[model samples]
Target: MTTGTARTVKVLVADDHPVVLDGVTLALQRTSWLDVVGYARTGRDAIAAAARLQPDIVLLDLRMPDMLGPETTAGLLAGTPSLKVILFTAYPDHAAVEAALAAGAHGVVVKDVERADLVDAIRKVVNGERGVTAGIETDAGAVTARHGLGGRGITRREYDILRRVAMGQTNPEIADALGLTRNTVKTYLQRLMEKLGARNRVEALARAHELGLL
Candidate 1:
């Protein structure tokens, strides 16, 4: 229940996959207070739509045929300074999640989440809360990187995996070092990908290398 402003949250859904976009749009529409203002099949389209629609939030998919994740996110922010962007993906990995938050995304969402929870997250952002996924818990006090960028704080465990991930650690190797089951390591990597706004682990690693984070 919302107060008198009708308080409709306008959103743009950006994803290259038609099935995912359609499913998300349908799910979002089920929330009475939210509206789909536009749709984008690529990152460039997303940025342009955000500028034109000036929507309150953008549900962005990290991998697009035309533009990559971080670059697309930067473009969206540059175009619509007031817009809140959420990286929506099926995969979630710590490094990826950390990268997205670092790249200026307000938060990240796993497309695999229950629909109601996803709707709740959308509302949270509309109400001016940082709707970071419970899975991407960010702590700003953990890193000693240059510039001492507190906002780039990812969990220590995640940081460790990112290093191994950089050195090309296999899932089994990562599991051994992190004391995690192979399946657990995979889940964490998927979470990281979502956080980093990366469509896949390869993409996430590539972006990390480019940012000199590796």
Candidate 2:
């Protein structure tokens, strides 16, 4: 929560999708604590909007057609020194996550996040706390272990597969559930097993659970 004297968090939302932009803007508008100051559909527009609006936070999408991933995050931050940025994404890759942290983003939130959580993240960022919405863990050290930033991190997809495996789902079952081919599941399993230094699925699950990756 913000101090009583503090102004509402002025927000600039940047996403190429109109529906997403409208939904986010409307949700923020519904909250008295947040003020939707502007909207941008591209990274260039976002940077311009940040400079013009001087917003307290920028709700950004990781994959913009014009400017992709961490580069957009870095650009926005560099241009607006006081701006706090929260990445909104469905596909959170390890490299992008590391780059975002390194570039001083305040948070990384998935796109399907609840409105309350989104509001909380905005408030947290405004108050100088790192905002991490659901599914994505906040432990930087743990993240480092998983995502070494050189194609080393156990990806979100891998973690998903591991969770399914922990539930005793066979490769075929997991494939059906995740909309992946069995061969693809097997490949991911093999790669994750190597990453975890596990001999097999059982050991992999054990290692993942121990590391809090499940």
Candidate 3:
């Protein structure tokens, strides 16, 4: 998914609705930095198009005909670990967000997102950062608490790190902010994940928020 330094970012858009697919594809193409490489109307088509197009980023719809968001994301990453995926959905439920992130999706964006925000999400994920759309953290907190998954306490430092993560800081960015080495920050993230029983930063931060640790 790495492009030449001079090349525009290539993107593949997948949505079940034709209007959505066309609109998003056109929106992305309007940006000078982004190039729309392909479009898919189903999860099966998404996986196949991704394998063939090998785009820098994939804007995937959460609910699709064949495979769901997580399954499609997993398939894409399985074929190319370097590819970035940002799940898109109008529903925006906590379980869907959690599942998508757990399946290795780089981010999640609500379908109603502004064009600029959507573009930002694509850019962020391609840069190895995670995108958590509006209302997700709040929803996650509610879901985590409702499921009784928020009783555990995390260390102060872990709480600090998770807060930074919720603020959308990447590992290296967090390391610099906290004056820690990047590897140490990585280790902390691993420990934090284990402590929170989270598969990714989004889940860890959300769970921590639900526990009132952040």
Candidate 4:
């Protein structure tokens, strides 16, 4: 005996490009086991649709006018409590890929792939398989340490913040966990940014990975 979910997958299509959205939506709609629950043309809209639809998978584009893929990914995970997202990108940089996975995107598809890869990626994510990009170790922290991604000598508290942020914990959660005020957490985040040469939390996380502190 097995669950019906083993056969069917529900999908949400989100992209800044109308043509890509329409194409993916139409392609998925053709399958008996797949349904296109909603289409979104912006990161904010994607979060809204995913929250309402609670689809099994979300096809997310990286470059949106309103938000980049990393921020959009964080928004999706923040908004939709039950949806899994798969990043869709023309560029597959290690930084972007790592950010997406840390932000809870289950997989990534380069834009040039044939439609079949998209369909199959949806199925894989629905089956509770994290479709990781090749060569990334699951142990981001250990990898980071081994590679000496540490810089400017992060303090223990900063280390705590970096670890939590890399694990996808928001500032509020980090604050609560560390028994610090949210403002304090924000300050620590800023300190980490300057020390690591990162522009923001996402950049910091990626930089950590690059230096092997991930």
Predicted structure with the largest lDDT when compared to the true one: 2
Each candidate: what lDDT? 0.71, 0.75, 0.73, 0.71
State the lDDT of candidate 3 residue by residue for 1-214, as single tens digits. 2322466888889998999988898788778889999999887788889899999898888767765666688888988777888888775653345556767887777778788888877776766676455425454335534443234545546655665676568989999978999998888889889988889888886876565443
- Sorted by TM-score, highest first, which candidate order results? 2, 3, 1, 4
- Which 10 consecutive positions of candidate 1 have the poorest summed lDDT? 140-149
Instruction: For candidate 4, give the lDDT.
Output: 0.71
Number of backbone-clashing residue pairs for each candidate, in the order shown: 12, 2, 0, 6
Q: List the residue pairs that clash in candidate 4.
A: 140-214, 141-214, 144-212, 144-213, 144-214, 149-211
Hey, what RMSD does candidate 3 come out at? 12.0
The whole-model C-alpha lDDT of candidate 2 against the native structure comes to 0.75
Which ranges in model 4 have alpha carbons more than 4 Å from their true place? 1-7, 133-214
Candidate 2: count of backbone clashes, pairs at least 3 residues apart or interchain: 2
Worst 10 residues of 2 by lDDT: 141-150
TM-score of each candidate?
Answer: 0.62, 0.64, 0.62, 0.61
Cα lDDT for residue 74, model 1?
78
Residues 1-214, candidate 4: write the lDDT tens digits.
1224655666778888888977877777777788787888888898888888888778888666565565678888888757888888765553345555666778777777766766766666776778543223343334334433333577657866786786668989989978999999999999999998999988997987676444
| Cα deviation of 99, candidate 2, in Å | 0.6
Ranking by lDDT: 2, 3, 4, 1
